[model samples]
Target: MGRSFTVYVAVLAATGSFLFGYDSGVMTDVIESPNFLAYFQTTQTSAIVGAINSTFSGGAVIGSLQGGLTMDRFGRKKTIQMGALICLIGAVLQSAAQNLAMILTGRILAGGAVGLMSMSVPVYQAEVAHPRSRGLIVGLAQQMIGIGFIVSTWIGYGSLHAPETSQLQWRLPLAFQVVPALVLVIGMIFLPESPRYLIEEEQYGEAMRVLRKLHFDGTNDEWIEAEFFEIRRTIEAEKSVAVQGWAPMFTVPQWRTRMLHGVAVQVFTQMTGINVIGYYQTIMYKALGFTGNRNTLVAGLYNCVGPIANFIFVVFLLDRVGRRRPMLFGTLGISLALICEAALNSQNPDGQRIGYSIGGVFFLFAVSVIFSMSFGPCSWVYMAEVMPMQIRGKGNAFAVGVGNWAVSTLWNQVSPIALGQIEWRFYFVFVAWNLCVSFPVIYFLFPETKQKTLEEIDLLFAQRIERIPDEMTQREKEEAGVSAMNVENTKLHN
Candidate 1:
């Protein structure tokens, strides 16, 4: 694709990511409203509160699995369109919710659509984008998510200033989720379905048309064909050993390891206590004695840091610094930050010592910065990068369905109850998960995928390098032969 067109598709697809963030972040501030609390009658049992928060996560698990079937069958563009339409339905229900049951149902409905988009967008973007810049292209999904986080928080903060009984405070924010969903639905009508998806469905003529539109200015047939040939070879390879369902993910060692890495990266990121803070920053702020707009303002400022950090990481850091190092350091930084937060809060377990929470707030903000730098962008990016071309849609859906959505539900459901019961000590759970689980998973298991093309990553895992020194050299030699064929075809144009 031309650069502008490429970015247009990426940004439009990434609105799914944006919605995911908006939905997650919207409730954070809304839950703090007395009117909402009063209406829900959830003060005595935080599980109802937990249900309101986690139902979306719970619904997302089903949505993600549905995405796997629909994305592969209907193509990426249509699947995304379907997701947006579903989200709009959810938004309408939420905007008009009369009781906690209605709002919970709305969130669950929206979660399914968001889950579909979440699984499809990155896959669509990766296949459509040039491999050289694919890291940032796919990574943009997460960056837009950070942008969504910002937009949702600001929406919540702005709504706080509205008339107390106007109902706009919470209702409007829930309604606003439709704006992005509507935009995505409209935009997809004009865009092409993923060329890769077309090829998989045996639509070669359409695939070539898309390839020409995506990779060149319609004059560079040689360049477009070269790219398509690589895709063809990979597809052939994938087809040769393809298993029916999830069996391949666990049966083949190479596939097993990559699948585990994809699943682990996702599960560990959620386990890092992000939901505890993300879902209930206002509660934490109130616990620390910051009342009213002071809490909203601080939460806004804290969430603001995320998108900025993510932009810097995806733009300037990812392709150059590679994935593993930054993720490892980010995990360690988050672990230490959690330890600091735990220690700071322990001094005021009852939150009566709110006078000394300045350090606690700082550590909380620090965790935001570090989390954005590493896991926020990288987790989804890593998941998208590691899956195979033939099974990319279904495989990614499985990983996100079980690892990301299921565990998020598990954590989000338990958090209100856990944090209420355990208080500051709850932070220790993530501290332990990071130390004992996340750190080792990234360090020992996750392979490096910096400048390597998606195809090369497949080779790296499939054809193991027992000797580290020959790894890059051997792969490049193989890639060079393919490059020579492409050069021969394009040399005349130059």
Candidate 2:
């Protein structure tokens, strides 16, 4: 795999994220459509409607938690294909639903598919990408999510007018999710499975073949060999522990801390309340008094801003800004935006007309812009960066399961009810929580990983640490660690 091929694989792999983003954003407007509400026999603000939307997230939580085991057992390509198959089932069920129970089941299945992709796709990208562009490849998952967001928003907007008696308003948008999933599974068949996964299973010949295919530009044999040796040594160090399964993740202090950092970043990412917008933009606009399709369009347009911001961030800011600074700085921006938006809503001087006002709309877009540039992409990129190879799948699943799906599901379950009950006051909770927790956790716990290789990230988190030598590549240094393990094996032989 040369540069173009690596990007080719990455782009197709990122289609799963497109599905994730679409499923996440599609419901935002569809759930608010009068036709949809009438069809489902539920009100815009009804608890049943909230349950309908949140149930998808509930399914995602399950998909994410179990996704790691499935990926570990079956490999990345198969895991993603399974997710696509399930998502297709969900899309069909949702399109044909006549009652809430049917749609709810569909929502769960769709959510499960998103959950699996959320955990597996990023790990797949991280494992295959060159360290020079690893952040960029991992960041593509986030960028595609933004693309998915824009696509779903436009789809919901276009389908808003299907006859009340007709189900196409919601049905078609739900059905459209299958296209990307179908493409993803087909494309994955032609792509290679992760070489890292191959090596872990003692498939050395296959792993070498993959490394050569990927890293050999016909002139980089030395560099490829270095990468191979580094991978080998890391696995050797991992095997030295002798603890299998989940136990290895916890037995080491650094690994434990790295896992926590992944979780903490994920927690704060959700706590920033971005998904609230992803799931509820139309309702929020309605509450702000932008009535009818105008409100829905505003939500769609507002969503459009995020993908652009995420694109710029990934291309320019991601590798440049490192992780902690952007996260902390962006958290502050999120807090400010929340406070401003909350204040604007609290005034409600002219009531719902605020959605039409320039100042009011500006702040709304501002919040999205800040979150898009900072928390939206950074959280996923940072988590992928921090997790070590041995436990990357399971470790990431825990972060995504707990933060993205679990916390998001819980929020979705109660937020409609909360928004109906509390209105502007609800935003204040996110503002204060972000202010209180984000800076402290990042400042105290997280380390910078801007230009470091994945193997060097191992060095950063290693229990018996030393400075990364100036002259030696991490691959060269890892040879020493492998030597120790080789000696241990020799002793056993004697």
Candidate 3:
């Protein structure tokens, strides 16, 4: 096994992300369905409709917190499987619902499942991937998410062609979510656990074997060995100092700073208004003069743009360009696009001008493209990379749950109502956030972590004590404190 094998495992794990994307994106079409509205007797702006979206996110918040514990206790692979199984159950409830109550329950359950997967999948991918390709590997989370969005939007569009009276118009897309969830559950059985995780469990022999399998390139045994020992030494150092429970995350200054960075990146990611656009772009298109099937069709095309842009960035630019620049530039770009959208929407208040409609749609697509290349993948990568192994599961989950889902829940609940009551004004909120808050925070605070191993990332946040050389006597090793070879390596890499 080599790079290809690592990629294979990463992609398989990303099926969890696909489910996350699909569940989130499918609702855009579901609520738009005339059959769904008629069957449930709810309009798009109804509080019930908002409840449907918000409940899922609310569930995810819970799932994310729980997933952190589960991932740590059961390993990454099993946690994903658990999430998929729960997703299957949620899909069934959603597809067969007879009233709003049932569907909302399903939405909450599905949301929880997504939350669990969201926290687990990226951590697993980051831990397993090679440093040189880590950005590409971890970025797959957002890439798969984009694919999930594309599939959901197209399926939702196609489902609209079904008889208006047929529940299949909404039910079919809801049901289709099970396919990927099922695949993730079964496919994970064959994949290996994270080597970092294995090391934490004191399974050094197994950890070494996994590192070799994941990184072996016919002649990189020396590099692989070095990485294995580096990981083991770092983990040992962390465990020796680690306090039990989640206290250290908040109490320690370095850990607190990392937690803030992780949480802020995710908060900024959601505040960029990607989900608001993804979940309710049909409404935006309607305001832009798209009617009937045109709105859904354009939404499908809009969803397609993100994946292509993200794919290009992940493969060609992510590691090369590094993280900080893309985020800084991406936030600025998203702000500009939202401004254009607001301006164009204001101009086409009646949705009568063809030019304004085109402009509005263009800017919408622009938001998706810029976000895909920048914040969409980078946020997940940053959160996963910043945490040490001792706290990664809980810390990443907390960031994703509190920052991503909690904020997402607020926006998803309010966006439709805001669009109904305030119209184009809501776009400005995100525009202001991007310009005044998100961009500056990223530029001033975030450090570049490109092409560095996970152990090396520790040096960026705090200074480590010097380590004795391997050739030193045991007494000398005890006298020298813990490992600091990575500090010198960090300097050399810089």
Clashes of each: 2, 3, 0
TM-score of 2: 0.91
Give the Å error, residue 89, model 2: 0.7
lDDT (10s digit) by residue, model 1, range 70-107? 88678899999999999999999998999877898999
Q: Compose the digit string of candidate 3's lDDT tens values, residues 77-115.
A: 899999999999999999999888889899999999999
Lowest summed lDDT across 10 adjacent residues in model 2 is found at 485-494
Model 2 spans > 4 angstroms off: 349-356, 464-494
Residue 155's lDDT in candidate 2: 90
Q: Rank the candidates by TM-score, best first.
A: 3, 2, 1
> Of the pair 1 and 2, which is ahead by TM-score?
2
For candidate 2, give the lDDT of residue 390.
Answer: 68
Query: What ranges in model 1 sit over 4 Å off?
Result: 217-223, 349-355, 463-494
Q: Give the per-residue lDDT digits (tens) of candidate 2, residues 1-494.
A: 57778888888999999999998888887876777888877886788878987899899989998887888889888898889889999999998888888899999999999999998998888888887777678888988988898899889888887666667788889899889988987888999888888877767557767777766687665566567656666766666654557766677677788888888888898898888867876767766777678888898889888888888887787877777787888888888877887777777744555444545566778878888788777787788888887678888888898877888988888888887888878888888888888878788878887667677787776652332213334454353333333322332100
The pairs that clash in candidate 1 are 1-214, 1-215
